[model samples]
Target chain A: MADNEFLGNVGGRTLSKPPTPGDIFFDKSFRFLTRAFTWATIFLLAFIVYKIGGKALPAFPDLGIKFLFTSVWNSSENVYGILPQIWGTIYSSFLALILGGFFGITIAIFITQDFLPYKVEFALKNIIELLAAIPSVVYGLWGIYVLVPLIRPLANFLHEYLGWIPFFSTRLSGLGLLPAVLVLSIMILPTVAAISQDAFKAIPHKTKEAAFGMGTTRWEAILRVMLPTASGGIFGALVLGFGRALGETMALAMLVGSMSTLTLSFFAPADTIAALLANTFPEANVGLETGALMYAACVLLLITLIVNIAGAVIVTKATPGGDRR
Target chain B: MSQTGLQLPQLERQPMEPRALKSIILSAITIACAITACIPLFSVLILLIYRGGKRLTLELFYTLPPGAFDAHGVGGFGNAILGTAFMVGIAGLISIPFGILAAVYLAELDPHSKISETARFCAKTMTGLPSIIAGVFAYAVVVLVMGHYSSWAGGIALSLLMIPTVMLTAEEAIKMVPNPMREAAYGMGCTPAQSLVKVILPVAMPGIITGVVLAVARAAGETAPLLFTALFSESWLSPNNPTASLAVLIYNWSSSPYENLIELAWAASLILVVLVFVLNIISRSMGGKTKL
Candidate 1:
């Protein structure tokens, strides 16, 4: 071993170590190159966020607190505030979350439980994944034409029956917050169900059996034991779904009426931050408009960042305390 | 101690009793929601077939969007399709190598390295950045730098959209390569790079290909990024010139005031959805077969 390590060249001079064919390529230059490339990618990403945000930072010394409160958004007047867009995005996305969370959790339970035959369960799982594969544009197109018409009657009916409520008071517009909420719900459902399924499948079989052994009914076992065990995962799924709904673009842009004005009625025209950017960026005629859009982009970026970090935390906490067999 | 201290006779495990009718109703409702999530897709396909079927002849594949309402009903998505393929190809070309390298840097060399961690955070953040945000960023970077919105600019934006997904997938694929293979390679005096390229990469090729295909499918259906960077074109297909893609074309036609335009939009959307669906099925099957 010592001889092998202190090898000599063919001329018989003692050497420190013999170089192998693989190590031949791992020179100082290659190492430096690899490190440089790695750093470059990192820098490029940071630069993108910065460049998208650089101009917006200067507009508000105090991080645009007042700009966020102002209700007007008249480009010709050089007046731009995002209060309406913020309220609209949050309200609609929250509605989507509430609706999607209920539906997604229920569906997940049904598919994972023993009520269905194994073949039927497998087919349903495949269908769920395939549902996710459909393109967002297809959803948008369908929303614009078919869904809009189909829901118009419902919107009018609601307006008539529930007009006392602030959110349902407006004249029914087929394309507005309600449709957007529905689309967002659909878009987020697959994500929530898929992730929740992973969590459900991970629950210990023994625990479930024990719950059943206690003469607990199937419903009681699922509700009392399985659901709580998977709560962290269910939270992760909600956060991930929120992230997706917050950033959804073409679908929202196409269906949600692009009115920047705020209204209490969910049936009124509205604009989300994402949909606003989609509509305005293409036609941005001046620097400030562009900067404002960048500011909006930065806001979207922050939301996504928070959502992802929170999701990661929940998922990590959900990992078993270590019986790593 | 009942005389013999014998344990009470154990109760037999019973088969699950039938659920209450309400519970059955709840389960049916849950299944309906799953089906509801699929309704838009189903309705769109049915609508497309109803409207575009008669007009979706072979001639529709060879003509351009007619300028006048009645000039030529037989419109081809030739430019849009070619443009989409070309742009997606360029995006895949740019993303895969860089993304794979980033994944390798993350998993193989230093799991806790600051650079890799920062790279990972950025990638995750970018994954949730709306495609429109990416489009705006690309506009600032590519369009501003090049002095015009072009196909090249669109390609850059789509690459940005694609890189994070590819990086995440590649990292998962690479992590699945058993560490013992890497150790064996090193025992034979192989360096990390040699071990990766000669042994690890080949073992992980199926997974990597699956990731790439899925990424391409994602890029192909993206409309928001292309909107700002590659504005629509009417008559010609040019890889060098500013061009619209199938997604963008569908957007334009669907939103136009003309009925014919709307019909063409449905047709194009049908084609795009089918293309994406096929790619998804392939990648999904590949995922099942190659999963470690």
Candidate 2:
């Protein structure tokens, strides 16, 4: 009460005094820095759009919609098509999502259940987070040195054994769609696993207890009860993982062979939008080349926007309101 | 199996024979996964020490990378390290204040406003945007518009990447400052900025520093954004020049066909990883100090 008395006097001296016209005007003048900074951030976005738009407009009139559909990326003749890059980005990211979803969810389940010791679970979770800490370039180097050699024979074996399959037909090049996909899988697994782990841990223990009370086995209880309860969270995790995979650059750049051609075989040459952007943005001379690169970035940005929106929607739907501990 | 007189759930709820075995098996696999995660981190560290350890005298830190690769000779990554320090330093300078201020605005002043909400959304989206895209943005705006890629362009890109992290962490730290503290400051006639810089910032200083340190560490190890904006140099090193960082150097060398170059790349990677690891540990140590 004493402190409030003192504070009341101070606040009254500052704010409750009959508003002097000069004091109010002076305060308004002091807001210049804040407003300036706010506008500066706004200007950054505007400038970015203008720079990208100025270059992109030239190609828009002539290329129309045909440019995106065509696969040819011939530079000498000045024809650039983004179909392969777009397709590669989608294909590799999808592959990452599928592989990471399966393994990450399984691991999350293993950790959440009474499958591992407490210390082991703790250590495994830290390990996954550590994987997230390592820079993407380091992952690329590791992938090239270890993962490629390690997976080459496996890829080759798959090619030889399952040559009839469309995706497994090409000879192992050690650096192509397969390597890119595998690297992306590894990169995204930790993301998915982390999110899924949180989801699984959030499930109420009473639900599993009730399932067990019904004479269900541990696996049966998890499959029938826990999985259904956490499916929304799992979906959110997948979307987040998908976002990470789509935006990944250095690692994918190193693994994706980087030839701008669309092909069916996973072992064939491929290029992702991010990889192409990273590769060409520095070297692009001017005008259309630069514009095309920005177009590629716009596509990358769109993919991320879609991923975030989808994840947000799923997460919002999954969470029930007014449920608190 | 149900009639085998082995009622597992009814009896101690443990499968005596299989439970122990399954636990052991799961424990082993978990351990293996942890070990797998550590392999690359440890390998990079060991590689750096093995290669750089032999020439770890004072001169190694004092000289630049020699033109030719000499296996047994001593040369340094002094320029690359300095370049990295400058780039990260400039980025930190540009980003830290703005980031912390924005975070303050979001967490404290007019937090529910449409502007704050939009800012928060952009900050979050920026957090997840590819580092390469930031580089692309910088290239388009700072470099291409200016008609040349410069260190400023690289620094700006890195700053963009660093902002979202700082903003998120700072907001979190400031939000933890107990509302009564802010209320008290306001009661004493301190302006919002004053309250932030004095009361809230002091209380949140350790967390903000920790966030800043982690952000610097990430910026230090970033290779993708630097590749285009900060182009590499062999002998001539200038902060004004579009210069390369240790991480990008490592990337280039590791991918090259030359055997000795690959070793140098590994050496650089080793150093970079250790630097980041040390920074990470420092942040973790600071993060462990406070409880939410």
Best by TM-score: 1
The chain B TM-scores of all candidates, as shown, are 0.88, 0.86
TM-score of chain A considered alone, across all candidate predictions: 0.86, 0.84
Error of 1 at A225 (Å): 0.9
lDDT of 1 by residue, B3-103 (tens): 67777764653344354444455556767876775565567668867766756767666677776466446567778888898899889888888788777
- Cα deviation at A281, candidate 1, in Å, is 1.5
* DockQ of prediction 2: 0.34
Q: Spell out the clash pairs found in candidate 2.
A: none
TM values, all candidates:
0.89, 0.86
Docking class of 1: acceptable
lDDT of 2 by residue, B227-272 (tens): 7888776654576676767877777766786665666566666667
lDDT of 2 by residue, A262-301 (tens): 7788888799888988777767757677777777677677
Cα lDDT of candidate 1 equals: 0.78
Best by lDDT: 1
Write one digit per residue (lDDT tens) for candidate 1, span A77-142: 777888888888877778898988777787788788676899987877776666666677777888
